[model samples]
Target: MADFTSRRTLVLRRFARNRFAVASLILLVLLFVGCYTLPAVLPYSYEDLDFTALLQPPSARHWLGTNALGQDLLAQILRGMQKSMLIGVCVAVISTGIAATVGSVSGYFGGWRDRVLMWLVDLLLVVPSFILIAIVTPRTKDSANIVMLVLLLAGFGWMVSSRMVRGMTMSLREREFIRAARYMGVSSRRIIVGHVVPNVASILIIDAALNVASAILAETGLSFLGFGIQPPDVSLGTLIANGTQSATTFPWVFLFPAGCWC
Candidate 1:
């Protein structure tokens, strides 16, 4: 417990010393708070149409201006941000969990387990995930299908991370602690959970962060192409795609959402 505490403290200290990471974290936190909280106080909802304010630039009455349909840009941007953030976070966590479980199990118990898991990973690695997702996501038009979108994103995203975890676990399984746990008659599950997984957590943490960005971009791309999030639902990609037509005349529509997405 003491060792774990010291390790955690050291990690926190290291994180704090990194100015970019700290700033990024602060900005992310603020964005999250703003996206969720500011919407209630805003005069317009994403769905509200204001025919009078169509294509209007940023102004006091319509803070981020109105889109072609007269929908408030700020309201839509915040709503889009909320959806994008949720999808990104959910996909990252689910994918990382799947990777860690499959990789650790495969590495700790070799032979058939390793062969099957690695074979699955290789198969997925070769499959065109983007094409598959694009083909399937459009079919799911209901608002409830957002969960399906998240699952699909996570399903196709874990292969590379699983391979990395498998390699790390292969080395970790042979370490003294792992060997000692085995000799003491600890269950394979406990040894993997308590000993092996914790050791490789650093890599998993990094992978999850990268996955968040990857998932968000993947979603944005799909949404831009009109296959993701669907109509009546807002996302940064959809906003950007919608904004592109009038980009020359009404730059605010594109810029505000694009900036929020970035």
Candidate 2:
């Protein structure tokens, strides 16, 4: 526990030392708070339609404007942001957990295990993940599409991270401490959990941060292609897709959502 606290403090200090990282973290926290809270305070909900305001431009009443369907653009974008953040955070954590576990296990117990895991990793690396997700996502029930999409994105997202973990674990396993733990009769699982995983955590932290954006973009692309969050449930991708038709005439339809995405 003491060691863990020290490590965490060190990490916090390291992160705080970077201006861009601090700014990004603040912005992310604000985004999360705003996305979840502001909607409740706003008069318009994403589902609330105002036929009178159809394709309206930004005004005091409707900050971002209204879509062709008469839905409030600000509400829709905030709702979409909530969904995207959920998916991005979930995919990043799950995928990174999967990668760390798989890589640590494979590297710690080399030979056939390593070979098989590496082979699987290589296989997934080559497969057309986006196409497969696109084909399968449409078939999922609307209620569970977001959940299914997160699973699919995570399923294919961990291969590279796992491979990186494997390499790191391989090097760590031969270190003096690892052998000392083995000689002291510590179980393989405990050693991996307590030592291996922690040592590789720096990389995992970086990967997870990167994965958040990657997952969000993946969800956006899939949704834009019409395979992501289904109707009645708005996502940034869906908003962009819906707005694409009126992009030239009603640039707010496209620009607001796209800008939020960026």
Candidate 3:
């Protein structure tokens, strides 16, 4: 207990000492709260349209203003944010989880398993993910389904990290602790989960965080291309796509969601 307490204290001290990380964490928390909570308290719904107030700028009644459709921009932005945040977090977790699992297994098992997995990774890495998504999204057309979007983003995002994880696992699997576990006849699953995965976890943690940003950008790009999160539903990408025409005249429509998305 004492040892664990000291470790926890040490970690907290280290984290707190990192001014940038501390600031980033605080800002992230605030942004999340604003995205998820503020919309509920606001009087406007994204769908609620007021034809009389079409293209109105920010006002007391419509805080962020109204779109050409007269729908509340604030509500739309909040809704888009809700979806964007969900997609980012889900894709990051799914992709990183897959990379860690596949890489660990391929590396630890070696031979045929390693060859097959590496071959698959090389194939995927060679192909352009954006082009693949563009071609596939039309057939699937599950843009409205958040789960489908998450799966699609995760499928494209894991290959590079999986290769990295594989290298890390290859190095770690031959270490003394791993050799001891193998000699003690610990199950491959247990050793991989308990030993190999944890050693590479710091890399995975940072990778996952970066992947969150990547996932958001990917989703936004797809949506902007008229592929992701379909109409009446807004993602940051879809919001930007919808507002492009008005960018010159009604810059607020284009900028509001884009700003929140960034």
Candidate 4:
């Protein structure tokens, strides 16, 4: 218990001392809270239309102003945030899970498994992920398209994570405790679950955060191109896409969503 406490304190001290990580964590938390709370408390709905008030400039009543369709820009931003964050979190979790499992299995049990998994990883790494998503999304139903995109991104995203985990596992498998466990007749599964996974978790967490940012950017790019979260739903990317047409006339339409991205 004392050892665990000391380790945790050390980790916290390290994290606290890292200014970049601390800033990122603070921004992430603020965004997360705003995404969760603002939509629920706001008076306006994302889909609500008041054509009479269309294209109004920023005022006391409409802080960020009204869009081309007369929907509240503020409301749209809040709602879009929720959607963007959801996609980012989902992609990160799914991608990390797939990467960890495949990488661990392949790394622990070498020979053919390692060869095949590595080959597959290499094959995926060769292809452009965005191109793959664009091709695959159109063939699927609208609802399924998001899932397909997530899976496609996760499938490709796992390669780097797999390689990282595989490398770590190779090093970890030869550790004194691991060798002791093996000598004590511990099952491969037990050694992996009990030893390997815990050791690799810190790297997994950091990678996951980086992946979330990447996934958000990718989703935004897709939505900007009209391939991501489609109509009747709003995302930061979709909002930005919609705003582009009216931006010259009503700059707030684009600026509000762009502010959220910043």
In order of TM-score, best first, we have: 2, 1, 4, 3
Q: Regarding TM-score, does 1 or 3 come out ahead?
A: 1
* CA RMSD, predictions in order: 2.6, 2.1, 3.2, 3.0
Q: Which ten residues in a row have the lowest lDDT in candidate 2?
A: 138-147
Residue 26 lDDT in model 1?
A: 71
How big is the positional error of residue 93 in model 4, measured in Å on the Cα after superposition?
0.5
Model 1, 1-262: lDDT tens digits are 9957865765566666657666656765687788899999998999999999889989999998999999999999999889888898899999999999999999999999999999999999999999999998854457578888999999999999988889989999989988998999999998888777777776676677778889999998899998898667888999999989878889998999888777
> How big is the RMSD of model 4?
3.0
> Could you tell me the lDDT of residue 90 within candidate 2?
93
Cα lDDT of all candidates, in order? Answer: 0.87, 0.88, 0.83, 0.81
Name model 1 segments beyond 4 Å from true: 1-27
lDDT string, candidate 3, 65-159, tens digits: 89989999999988887888878888999999999998999999999999999999899888888888766765223545567768878998999
Ranking 1 against 3 by lDDT, winner: 1
Candidate 3 lands at a TM-score of 0.87
Question: Better model by TM-score, 2 or 4?
Answer: 2
Q: Positional deviation of 199 in candidate 3, in angstroms? A: 1.5
User: What tens digits encode model 4's per-residue C-alpha lDDT throughout 38-70?
Assistant: 877777888888788899998876788988888
Clashes of each: 0, 0, 0, 0
